[model samples]
Target: MRQGSNFLWFLRAAVGAAILLGAVLLTACGSVEDVDLTPACPTGVGRGIWDPGSLEGKDAGPEVRKLLESPRFGATPQAVRDLERGIVDQRLIAALRTLTQEHRICVRAFKEGHYFLPGVEDGPRIPEGYGKAGGLPNTHYYGRAADVWWVDGKPVEGNATDQDVMEIGEILAGIPSGRRPDQIIGPPRWARDLGYGNQRGWILAPDQLELHRDHIHIGYVNGEATNETR
Candidate 1:
């Protein structure tokens, strides 16, 4: 009878262990599923939280934290460092990565005063203050935009020639429009060629020859407007 009791106790312990193991496995699987796990941008780099309101250094939520850690945005050493301190949209980072990698070029984070809320007296206004049609600042205020220059084969933040920067813009212009009415703004031809006559909104073409001569601007645009400049 004692032998029989020992066997029963062993069986009970074994069953308990199996149940605990199953619970652990189930918890892990559930965790993987419950997380958004969506590619940060469209390129399968990182997980992006769509909240544009969370600026860098301001919002460190789990979703945004995951995006900041993505390797796709870590093109140049400077870019990787910038990702730590600044907050730009995941799409913008992904697009910039594509441009630099495709052409073997290098670009860094926008100069300190360029992004929305540069935290300086003379910094440029966010797009919301641009005073133009469809200029509600969805892109700049949300940190979904960048002004990148071509530093051919140099480290991020390296100086770029005018021709090299223009070339970078041309390639960036060809990227398809995004879920929002995104644009690549630089030389007129680049914008006109890619943005002509599509259901999507027009990519802006600079009228002045000297506009954006130093860099290319690409990112989201204001909401749809009938009078939006193409």
Candidate 2:
């Protein structure tokens, strides 16, 4: 509640405008203040714990302002925010965040009351066989699937040598495989794996994840993968 004072003030401002003569108006024009730059990622390239503005000096947009104004979507939702992208389809983002929260995953960006690691993940790279299933099984082209080395932004260094990825993967298995489809290639061998990454070989490195070697591919909001048939 006290962490973000700027939004707190706007919360009481009432939509930045007033309504009159059947016309709605805000108190002032909408503008985004410049956000702070970090050494790890100067351009705000990586994902943040919460929204971009929550960082040291990022501009809080109208969406953030509206969220602040609404007392209902406070504290709870903010506590689990991890991926904060400036996308027009906010509903989809909100849905993903909600799903994460429902699974008890503590997201950095969604959560307002907590302090989180500044950088979650650097950016997902495009894996091979995008938009089309590769020569391997369970591999397909759809914006919905991705071979992420990291989840929610943080990399899970594994599959080759980084034991961290395994630890993270174990935790990530918390979400339903059908929904997350995070790795979608090679998950853990012994443990309960996700639905998409149920293929053979390559147990834990983002590199050996078939279609993904150096960089993983993240699909768009409405992407679909052709598994089993491929």
**Per-candidate local distance difference test:** 0.46, 0.32
Estimated TM-score for each candidate: 0.43, 0.30
The numbered model that scores best in TM-score is: 1
Q: 89-122, model 2: which lDDT tens digit per residue? A: 2332332343333221112222123211133221
Quote model 2's TM-score. Answer: 0.30
Q: How many residue pairs clash in each candidate?
A: 2, 34
Once superposed on the true structure, which residue ranges of model 2 sit more than 4 Å away at CA?
1-143, 146-159, 186-211, 215-230
lDDT of model 2 at position 196: 33
Q: After superposition, how far is residue 160 of candidate 2 from its true place, in Å?
A: 3.7
Give candidate 1's root-mean-square deviation (CA, Å).
12.2
Query: Which stretches of candidate 1 lie above 4 Å from their native place?
Result: 1-82, 106-111, 115-135, 151-170, 173-181, 189-202, 205-210, 222-230
Error of model 1, residue 169, in angstroms: 4.7
